[model samples]
Target: MSSTDIEPAESRRPARYHAKREAILAAAALAINEQSAKGLTLADVGRRVGLTTTSVTYYFKKKEDLAAACFSRTLDKLLEILDQALEEPTPQLRVRRYLSLHMARLARIQAGQEAPFAVLSDLRAMEDPLRGQLLAGWRTVFRRTRSLWGSPATRVHADLYGARAHLLLEKTFWLPVWLDRYDAHEFDRLEARMMQLLTHGVAAEGQSWAPELIPLVQIQDDETVNRDAFLRVATRLMNEVGYRGASVERISAELKVTKGSFYHHMDAKDDLITACYDRSFNIMTTAQRLSDTVAGNHWRRLSSVLASILNLQLANGEGLLRTTALTSVPAHEFALMLERSHRIAQSYAGMISDGVAEGSMRPVDPFIASQGLVALQNAAFDMRSWASTMPRERAVALYASSLAFGMFDDRVLEAL
Candidate 1:
């Protein structure tokens, strides 16, 4: 039926009531793109769909219900991608095609032509059974993606293809944010190029890759007797399962320490997460500073910074700090961490701005470009499985080259 046929406030239910509800959920998805679900009101949703607030409430009693329905529908879309990829005949082709199609989808969003996929906030803010159900759906996609695409033999650990997939997927959710800075076009090229680039290191034939040195930056280690070990263990858990899954009990079990030992180090899990965020960002800051000390042009500086950041995982086995960790921190710490994140971005933009000014890089919006770089480097977390299977230096070089050059031909990178 046409949209015009749907009544704004039908006093009686029609046989197509479920279809109408689905329509409302579609509108909710569009509205959610502009504002988070928590900030979204029933009136706003009604405004987006040309319905009265009462009419909206009639379908989904609360705004949360509407948002929940929207998220559930997104899960349907995600599953569709998985199912489509599974149709491909080869494992590598399946993975490549899946990444390509998904990147193209994100490009559409970057061009302001479509709504974003569900954000992390969307999943976390959702209450109860719906959240659990949605995450189960998400996990199902990862498991299927791994089984259908990942190689059976990986040095990272057998059956840990999921870890590698997570690493690649880490940046996909945030792709639209910075992707607009580049030419918004069919991104299948990016998928194919990146896949090939990753398989074959960016090193020109017979050109030896000199591994850059990145030191382990120390963190605030006074929290406990073995704070360094404790933090390292916590970082592993956070990277593996995530902040939510890394319970104090689980972390303690891994550390072979009792709950009292954990308490001795930190008062609670939230505090531990806060410390992890602090240390992770501090490590990045240290890398940024070290990148500055290198004697080279801005392009060289940016490359060094990218290499150093990737080396956090490549050299040290620590993943990049997640921005979502800020929300889980205390309000005051949240504010602080939020500012710190901005500073890091700003510093990154500064380097890009310098690059543009000096003619080492093409002109682009430094802010957006910096963010895009950060999002890409986030794949360093994939190094969990990747570093094991691939040489760290080679992996870092591939990431730096692909991110710097993207789909564009830049001969300068060849010499850099």
Candidate 2:
């Protein structure tokens, strides 16, 4: 009561201060999006808005403070998308539209042609206050989504469909920037196929059964039980700490097993890693099965399959591990893994080809389109590294929609 009374006597400066603070924040975001955040300066923002550095300083004490303000504004925009999507009539359609819109925004940003949207990857490295604000916005979005779709389903979708969408968009937008030769139309086609797979199941009617192919495993094990458990623990450790930094000792401790027990499970860490690779291959096979079982239109079936594949990865929380394997694994080992991953990509292409034949998808070069889609999704894994100051979920969604929509046909896209 006494504190409340004292506050009433204080000047209304806080309200006025916040209004000015928001303006400075908005200006900073604009500057960062126009140029690399790494080289951004408070002076740049002031100049853009025709203010002196001193005037900018009156609102933001430091460059970091201004950066924080920009981050907050970005988060607000992202949350708005989520809110609008959830408010749509059909939850599924809303989800799809949200993805499309989000991707379009990312494509625009990646072109360096527009202001960058807030990326979840970007927010990961922000200071606590900024991070908290971004997280709070995400929570509000999540709560609203939950009200539309039950929490369990929403959470599952967030991990599976949501994460898939995010990764897809991140890659499509960033790769062009990185390589400087990316085609936006090609990316659009790839996104369409991916979305089709996610919406439909993967198995084509009359598809023949083939023996489940087990990729070569370099790990030697005395017993399957020990091999399986050791691989699981090793995968977790490797994903968390990376291959070079991940130690056998830490994995053993987590398993509450002696070094001798760990050795009993595998010949060495390399062996365990190989086993983990084998497991990843096997998991993909299982996903193919689930995709085949779902009954729907070709696009619907493909979507189901895509969702399953993404769900498996999200369940593992091994996005970092996959990224590390691609970029940091020993060159020889990486080459082998890359080959296997390519095969999987080809299989995905085959599914799309089947869809076109079945009149579910528009005719296209499945192999080339699949490669682009794979590239986009793969690039998404690194989005966190680039956008370390933005909200993670928003970054993920933005990337996914971009990749998906970029692949859709002009006619289908117009309807969306």
Candidate 3:
């Protein structure tokens, strides 16, 4: 017999290997959902799959490889949503369909209809190789959505539109879990309000604000060239690793500088975190100014502002806000950040009020609606950081659509 000739048994090896790999990945996702990705191990996955560690290793050479496989599988589900959304008749309807399906899927996940997946929550923990793979997957999904719309303008709109979708899905599905509450009807209203806001401007009918009359301030720094590069690196490191876990030594090593040099820039880790909060505030304020200018109906303007806020959080680099939430920063500084966040909320509420007065919005409680909308968006951000499988565009689209439903007039929501 020729060496090139293979028996039927050998030919089936590849098929069997693929099935084994799928089982291992499914087991890993279960382990992660129950105990978090940090606690997942090869042995845990093997036991869950009723296999020996050695047999599991036959598919995934290492625990990291297994983790990557689990993460990819989760992303595959998200991509499936995008695929369904693209099949809709119009770009606008495509977006609506996408949001509806995403919400339903999220509900299923929350109801324990299926095993929990941790790709989103553990994305930051993934090694670079896995992170790259995830990003590539996201890009492919976006590209497909863009192609379906077939217009440059629609593609641009799709970016923000898609982001809103992802944000809403994550918020609706994950927030209730965090708060230990389940209100499907409440989520439905939230989704409707978000869509209304995205499609219409927040300013009510016959109401207009003097756009050019808004005041602008100028700031002058004497030390124009003096930048706190060390503090910047330190903050990012601390945010990524947590204050207790992040060492000055690691920061110094990352910067390729000496410990003495790091000490020259900051007194301690606490000081660095405080500085980061200050910097973040300034950046956030600037973003608020830009978002405030989005001109359209009351709903549209409000959606634009909300979209800007979500984008800012995502762009600030992962883990910064999470670190702020989980770490022990100074109480005074924490209070200050809270005040700043409150101010943003107040501004958003004012826009809603403006819309209500102008007849563009129906009679509704702007204060309660605004607070609820902001809460929904913030929850979505938290969930996105946690799930890490859904793309930022999809998250934002989902959130904006849901929030618009809660905030918009019933008539406007019905049109969307």
- Each candidate's TM vs. the true structure? 0.59, 0.45, 0.56
lDDT tens digits, residue span 7-54, model 2: 343445588666565556656665554443433587887887777999
Better of 2 and 3 by TM-score: 3
Tens-place lDDT digits, model 3, residues 1-416: 11123468755687777667667777788776554555568998888878998988887788877766676666666667778887887766666666677667656766767655544555555567766776676556546654444444443344444444444444433433322344655657655654554344344444322222222222233423122555555555554534544577887776677788777777766676667666655554554566556566665666665665555444433212332332245557666666665676677677778767765665555644555555554544444452244565554544454355432222322222
* Candidate 1 positional error at 287, Å: 1.0
In the range 49-166, model 1's lDDT, one tens digit per residue, is: 7889999888889987777767766666766787888889876667666677788777776776776654544565466776677667667766776665445553332223444455
Instruction: Sort the candidates on lDDT, descending order.
Output: 1, 3, 2
Higher-ranked by TM-score: 1 or 2? 1
Whole-model lDDT per candidate: 0.63, 0.52, 0.55
Q: How many steric clashes between backbone atoms does each model show?
A: 0, 42, 54
Which should have the higher lDDT, number 1 or number 2? 1
Error of 3 at 393 (Å): 20
Rank candidates, TM-score, best first: 1, 3, 2
